[model samples]
Target: MGSKPRILVARAIFPDIVERLRTHFEVEDNPGDGIWTPDALAARLADKDGAFTTGSERIDAAVLAAAPRLRIVANMAVGYNNFEVDAMTAAGVQGTNTPDVLTETTADFGFALLMATARRMAESERYLRAGLWTQWSYDMFAGGDIHGSTLGIIGMGRIGQGIARRGAHGFGMKVIYHNRSRLGAKLEAECKARHVGKEELLRTADHVVLVLPYTPAAHHTIGAAELALMKPTATLVNIARGGIVDDAALAVALRERRIAAAGLDVFEGEPRVHPDLLTVPNMVLTPHIASASVPTRRAMASLAADNLIAFFDGRGPLTPVNRPVAHPRGY
Candidate 1:
């Protein structure tokens, strides 16, 4: 207890945040931001009491076994899908995540992606850049309208509610949402969103947006069948985690014009997108950056750092995704 707690920051973060951690702990940080495989991550974690991990790091049972001294992991993301949460808890290791900080920023990016997809902005940009615009035709680059249209949102969490508020209030959209549990009456009225079944939302909405979390049950929430249900003029936007949509199936749907277009910020096994999606002109793809605003990202890192500091200081975790016994501070 006399020596400072030794911690590893698994990914490159702001130097200021690292320095803050250093003030309270023996800090080892990644300045180059290199990706670490599970074995590598375990090796680095071997002697540490705590770790600051990003979404890409896999903290599984095997990794946990290798790091017997490790007790807490602070994840710099809203989604703890990267963590084997059950295993961490079983091993008496606390896991925490950054939430609420990036909700509005992510919602903004989701809407922007939806607008770009519906308006054919990216496709048109490619055409112009390639010098393929010989003449302006009345129907040239004409795309669907967003205003006063129906908006379908899957997984109505905080960020999803923000997106719903934007569509319902800002765009005058009739918002319908599908979630594991329906929002309360007041919450629904506040966002002007209606609770609906998944199939109905897919069949009828003018634009469908995915804001769901990643889990085994949520894997491939939108696949070939769901895509086929959508109107041929409909648009699909995913700002959610990868594996929510079957990327290969989406590629085929876009290639066949089954759906008018899709804008994806996350993909299955990205930043390696499906080869077929690349060939489809009706798709807009982005790296997973929905929560990428400068201030928001820094806030996320700050919260993650806060979790590590708070737990070790006996104040308990700020936002723990799992409850592990043996809190050194006795929560």
Candidate 2:
């Protein structure tokens, strides 16, 4: 066997990043972006010591069982629901996620999505392009006002806090949020925001933004029941992971004008939006690009790469999620 550690790059990354990894280990990269079946992944992982994976790769017990030599799984995305933590821990394989680097960029996109949704930017642009704006009227494309509006936020994590600060201090809007636990009073004061229950948040806010993580418990946090709670003039924004909201229900609400408007950067079945959402006139849809800024994406990749490098160097990973599984033979 060769002395160098064997690693797999599950998807194509920056060429520079691949070159860097090549310098450290024997790199097997999927340059063609071909979809690998679970069995194929397991077979490839068998001889590998570690892997560089994106959110699409599933690092669960079955794959780990097939690859007893595997040590670390470095994920390029901030979210790691793609991983099965308990399974990884039992198999004694480490997991790391890229974070902090994507926070500001994602926050920027989230705020922009909210503004675009409230202002009917996409719909108005389409109308003009379709030659429907031949004559301008006083109320032509008069959308919801964002400034001095009530901004209700769900899930007060880093990105959520960033949005709250912008809405509260920058736009002179009142910000209310709901989270798993209450943020400290100091943080609340810093953001100039208040905390409220989910229902109260949905009912009271002029604009609603979702920034929570995705978990089975958090699935469909916003669905038919919650959508019904919002004001008919209110706008909704989702910049979090897809499954956090029920896309089908959201589409129904948009098509029926049950809600004034919605801005979605992620969907339950992403890269493939609901047909109803496409038919809706009051919706803005975007593929998941909340964290796609140039610098941020590079940082995220470098951070994941760093985790792999550190793990191979006999040092702890920089941002390990399943840290307890950093060792083999049962962590």
Candidate 3:
């Protein structure tokens, strides 16, 4: 505590963001953005007083044990499933995340994935690319309709409401959602979204989108049993974290033509996809890029940097996820 606080940028981010952190702290950054094991990450954080982490890095009790001087960790992504919040709290370390900045961008990508999934865009592109489009028939590559259809959204938070507004106002689609809690009357009216039971949403909607956060209780939320409730022609989209949807079960559903198609922006154990999911022709997969827009990403990085700066400046954390009851180690 006698010297200036040192921080680790756990992953490669905007160079400017690193420089911004440098002004306030002694910074050690990973320009290469290499994926690090727990031991490796712990080694870097061993001397750091703070850290700016992207969503991929895991910060838990083990890492915290190695970094006795670390006081704060700021995550660039709103979803901090990678973090062990309870563990960090017990270790007297603060956790922060960037929220509200990427809501619109992520929602936009969610809708785009929905449209592409419902319209069979990727499948058709693949067909044409394989030089199999010798002739065009009236019903060729026909997919489900979006307009006048029921749009079911899970996790009706900020991004969910954005998608709801888009569907209701722009596409004339009926929006229904299921969340941990129901939205208020005025807010629901604004988005034209109705809160419904999960079963009802799955069974009735023509399209379903998952925007929920990742938690142990939320794992495989849309598994075999839930998929069985969805209509055969319904298109599914997951822009949320991996492990939210059971990719293996989804692949089975897709292969058996149980569902029309699916679009997945995140996957389980990614960037290594399920072998079955990769082979399923009816699903559209992305490499966790739903929030990858340059501006949004920069904003996320800036916010994370700001959190680190704020904590070191004695302003505390701006978007803290947990509170530590004890003082920082060596403070």
lDDT of 3 by residue, 62-181 (tens): 999999988899999999998999999888899999999999999999999999999999999999999999998999989999999999999999999999999999999999999999
Q: Pick the candidate with the highest lDDT.
A: 1
Candidate 2, clashing residue pairs? none
lDDT (tens digit, per residue) of candidate 1 on 69-109: 89999999999898999999999999999999999999999
Estimate the Cα RMSD of every predicted model relative to the unseen true structure: 1.4, 2.1, 1.5
Ranked by lDDT, the better of candidates 1 and 2 is: 1
Can you give the TM-score per candidate against the true fold?
0.98, 0.96, 0.97
Clashes of each: 0, 0, 0
After superposition of all CA atoms, the RMSD between model 2 and the true structure is 2.1
Regions more than 4 Å wrong, model 1: 329-331
Best candidate according to TM-score:
1
Weakest lDDT window of 10 consecutive positions for candidate 2: 322-331
Instruction: Give the Å error, residue 24, model 2.
Output: 1.5
